[model samples]
Target: MFFAGDIGGTKVNLALCEVHDGRITTQFLRRYSSAQFGSLSDVLVRYVKEIGPLSGKIEGTCFGVPGPVLNGRCHTVNLPWTPDSAEIARDLAQVVEAGPVQLINDLEATAYGIGLLQKSGQGLSILRAATGAIGHRANQALLAPGTGLGEAMLLWDGIRHVISPSEGGHADFGPQDEEQIELLRWLWPRHKHVSWEHVASGPALHRLYRFLKETGRETEPAELAEALAQPGVDASPVIAAMAIRGQYPICVRAFDLWLFFVGAEAGNLALKSLSLGGIFIGGGIIPNVLELFRRPAFFAGLDSKGRMSSVVAGMPVYGIVDPLTALYGAAFSAAHSHGVLHGFR
Candidate 1:
């Protein structure tokens, strides 16, 4: 057996996984509210305790966390606790006998899972097929907008694609139009330095809604306004749910803007990485609003580049509909890294 987790600020996706019938399958899976736990060890202890003796048979475990993982340690912005790989390994190693727990950037885990996902055919839904020359041995890029924007590059090294984590989401926000410029102006006073993540993430959707409502660009719905008024509620999900249901025009507009921002940033990531292999869209946000991602308008700034439009136009685009990708990836990495599993492309 193997253990895996995709730990985010809001929730921790944990699973007891293993290679079964020549494929990785989960024996158990559950999501824990991150705010309820004080640390990762706390969650792990509870997980092992619940699973009982089976936890001792686990071969290894990997955790996918937000932000960069340096020397087996990570400090994330959204979560209250910082996760350390060595510490987690130490705590659970003896009790669960699951070997060392691995920690990796969530994007890296997602990158590792891309191939496994493609193999399964359920994770990636092609939004746009490649129109230009494609390279089988070329690099790829990932753009995920969840609680925050996450980006990564898959570097091809002849035999396998290596995962490289990035904080490019925090890069400066580039406006695409006069309206977007106005939005930037609106955010300038609030954020000292606005980033692509500032306008593209889940929370950013709420901010976009606020920007539109405050600017009088759209009339806020009365029922939606009541929901937003509730304390400590995530307005993003409410906005996304309402917009997807086509129940509120304001929510639709805000979600539309969010898609545009994601598209623009995706284009930027592709250009920076020269990802001729393709671009994979993964995250909590895209799967929920996949219908919006499939629209032509979602690739707006991607091909609007002055001289390199065709180059980008040819790059394939896929949206990961499966939300458990990161968690599965961590499990794969744990088995593969520990040399218990092999033949991973």
Candidate 2:
């Protein structure tokens, strides 16, 4: 048996999965708000008490943390506490016979989950002939937009799979038009280097809304949703809310802008790695507005590269709908670390 967790600032999900018949089976799963406890240890204690008997036979565990893990310790991006993998190992060791614990970036976990998806043929796939042109196997990149932008790539490392992390999302946001340039000018005073995270994240969305309000444009997704449902007053939510409602011009425009950047970024990644692998969009944001992504403009951006357009065109793109993707990646990491699965760790 193995234990794993997907820990974030707002919530933590803990689960136990038993490796049997070459498959990882979920034994138990639970969720808790991190703010409700002083430390992650408290949540772990409660989970163990409720689940019972996690001793002796369990091999190891892994954690997917939202923040960077340096020297085995992680500082939560939005929370007031820090987590040390060594300390966590010692504590859980008492219960599960003291095994090693692995810590990986949350984006790394998402990448692993993405690799798993490809292995199962449950993810997007590119034309084999097209991949042959690049002389690589099919795979995808994971772009997760949450508190900040997180990115990872699952690539065919010759023989097996490898999950590579990227700080590209923080690589700077280039404006595409007059409006975007104006937006960037508005944001420059507040931040030194504005990356995609500056305009593509949750807080960024709120910031845009605030900007609109400051400019005398009403910007409330909830209010827009309410208004659109009533019919006479035509208002739009964020890229997502409008997408979900089906058809609204302002919502459509908002989503178009969002997709243009996302696809262009994906194209850039695809070019850098020569990823014959597809691009998988993960995050709390895009899956909510996936319907809009299917629009013509979105795919156009992915194929917008002048000379390299043909190269990116062949790479498949997918939006991961599963919320537990990172958790699954944690489980995958644990299994691989134990040598239960090849190409893991």
Candidate 1 lDDT over 214-256, as tens digits, reads 9999999788799899999889998989988888888888888
Model 2 lowest lDDT segment of ten: 123-132
Candidate 1 vs. true structure, TM-score: 0.94
Measured over all alpha carbons after superposition, the RMSD of each candidate to the real structure, in angstroms, is: 1.8, 4.6
Report, for every candidate in turn, its global Cα lDDT versus the true structure.
Answer: 0.85, 0.70
**Cα shift from native, residue 26, model 1 (Å):** 1.0
Candidate 2 lDDT, 78-192, residue by residue in tens: 6776788888877765555535788888889888776666556563323123444543264556677676777777777667657777777788888767877877887888887
What is candidate 1's CA lDDT for residue 55?
28
Q: What ranges in model 2 sit over 4 Å off?
A: 54-56, 93-98, 123-139, 216-239, 246-250
Which number leads on TM-score?
A: 1
